[model samples]
Target: MITRTVVMRAVRTVVFTLALPCLLVAVWWVASDSSTSVYAPPLRTILSRFDDVWTADRIRGDVVPSLLRLAAGYASAAVAGVVLGVGIGLSRTARAVCEPALEFLRAVPPPVLVPVIMLFAGIGDTMKIAVIASGCVWPVLLNTVAGVRAVDPVATETARAYGVRGAAWLRSLVLPSASPQIFTGLRQALSIGVILMVISEMFAASNGLGYAVVQFQRGFAIPEMWTGILVLGLLGVVLALLFTLVERRALAWYHRSRGARRKAGSGGA
Candidate 1:
């Protein structure tokens, strides 16, 4: 049976997908209406800069560095968040104490944290990665904790009946069951990670895409700044698409598991 809820959700998704590119183009067209030197670059002009950015030297010098920093920092955040989240989730006392602090810290904006991080780490790749990792970790940690705690008690008990316990139990039962939530957290973290990575570079750096934007802007290269911004936007879109594909595959078992339960319930009813 097709429920109104499911149908409406599908309709909304279709509407959103259709609306997004239209909105982007509309905004681009409006902005491009101006020929003024400071305000906006024409869409065609921004696209033209891609040839310069994607050149072998530019790719190696700027884009590659930014991407490498992003990946390194984000990867560290993922690993640390999952481990710490698992620890906190599994221990009630730890959760009670740590959750409040984490809550407060997570509420603090990452841009605010950059100066403090830089004070210690300085303006090197270390600072860049540290800032990104700091910004990204909370989402992953909180999500992992939520996921672990959300495991069905009945399923856990069943696993226990088969002698599962400790680390073995977590790997065999918990992570698999909690994977969907974990991935959700990861997707959120990556979003945050990307924003912070650029901001980190923009605020203070001699190289990277953000630095390129800054360099161009200082020299009155508005079109190049527009190009960098556009590339970042496209990068975000591509990354989100990749994550969605991974999410669908990774959560396939979880989806099927829930679907099976639903089918059983409907048959009984």
Candidate 2:
């Protein structure tokens, strides 16, 4: 059963969440209604053309391939980053040995590496996925290391004292402590992956959303181009929302613990 307060809060959230977007759409509609710019099409025209351009064929050819590359790259980065991050975080020697190389690689922007990747992997899906993975890996790696290192020393000592040894100890204690930071990295990586996916397709792709947008712009299909841009924005928002839901579910315990701590502090005060 929902209380009045809960209902009110839900209503308020819905209003605040939707208010800005609706306002912006209203403004855009009003502002562009009478405009005659070739580059900036009217909002209504763009909306109408969205269905024509982003049809089933386009979705199968462009959107599906783009999503596949993003998923493959992001998953690979998450696994590799966590593994390497764990090693570096847990071992001072590993951290010292790898820090310089990792720093150098991370400093090189992923977009710049597209040419170099193409030289080796050619202009295939593999190259695109590699570029996305390269861009996404650093955030997760750095965040995981930071999270692991930030785990309470006292907790580690206590675990050691209690004979919580080996992989069991790491799985039970270390991973949970570091999960928050790891998730932070994953979130950062997700955005990077999306950016790289587009950039990769822009550089040397025959298909994908980015390629379509580029093609549309080159062909002077202003409304279609705008539609592509709008779709990309919507995709980012949708992916972010999905990730947030997953994060909340995965970190429910951490959230509850923090809430409990806050309540205790307030009570004491």
Candidate 3:
């Protein structure tokens, strides 16, 4: 199963993925080796502080809370987006009724809503979660709507002719057809969720990665602030990889179908 070709391909993939990041790190290390600026600390100095700055206690107090909020918000957004998107996609009347409101809301930036949300939801985890959800929902909702609308009419007719109806039809046909677009929305929402999490935390928060970063900046802890940013970047990369794994698993059938189609086309050509 684990052939030399597979191993070599895996190694090549890893190298390609990491090449840019490794180069950037090397450049930063060399460039900042003798920096004396208060704002821009040496990369070595920043790396050195990782052990002391991001200890178990700090991670427990800050990073975990931020991640939990991000998860909650992202999940809530995904569910709401897909359900509402499906409904709107299915009914022309529903789409017409909701279009204006959707456009208005989407046009308004999520960050601007933070203060307004804080006014109603207060400066609790609720507000932060809401902020993240507000930003994350738009991408998924819009993408799901597009995906659903784009479902092949031929496939729909085929499914209906086979006595597939109602929820059975939806499960057997609609979801699978729309899943690729829905996944696209989800991928976009993830980055927005990360951004909103930090923005929300930066305002009236006691314990969160963003809050910790702000505290470090105010206290003139440059290295610690840099470390917090570094942690956030690492967190995004990890989340993205996890999402890719899930997407690949979920869309395995779609991928296979596309591959078959391509092969058929090539053979015909």
Q: Which one is best on TM-score?
A: 3
lDDT of candidate 1 over 14-128, digit per residue (tens)? 8998797989888877778665556476777777877875688877888889889999999999999999988898789999999789989989999899999999999999999
Assess the local accuracy of residue 248 in candidate 1 as a C-alpha lDDT between 0 and 100.
82
For model 2, the local distance difference test gives 0.95
Would you estimate the TM-scores of all the predictions? 0.86, 0.97, 0.97
In the range 1-269, model 2's lDDT, one tens digit per residue, is 98999999999999999999999999999999998999887899999998899999999999999999999999999999999998899999998999999999999999999999999999999999999999999999999999889989999999999999899888989899999999999999999998999999998689999999999999999899999999998999999999999999999999999999999999999
**Candidate 3 deviant stretches above 4 angstroms:** 267-269
Itemize residue pairs with steric clashes in candidate 1. none
TM-score for candidate 2 = 0.97
After superposition, the stretches of candidate 2 with alpha carbons farther than 4 Å from their true spots are none
lDDT (Cα atoms) of all candidates against the true structure: 0.87, 0.95, 0.97
* Candidate 2 minimal-lDDT segment of 10 residues: 165-174
The lDDT leader among the candidates is 3
By summed lDDT, the worst window of 10 consecutive residues in model 1 runs over 33-42
**Rank by TM-score (best first):** 3, 2, 1
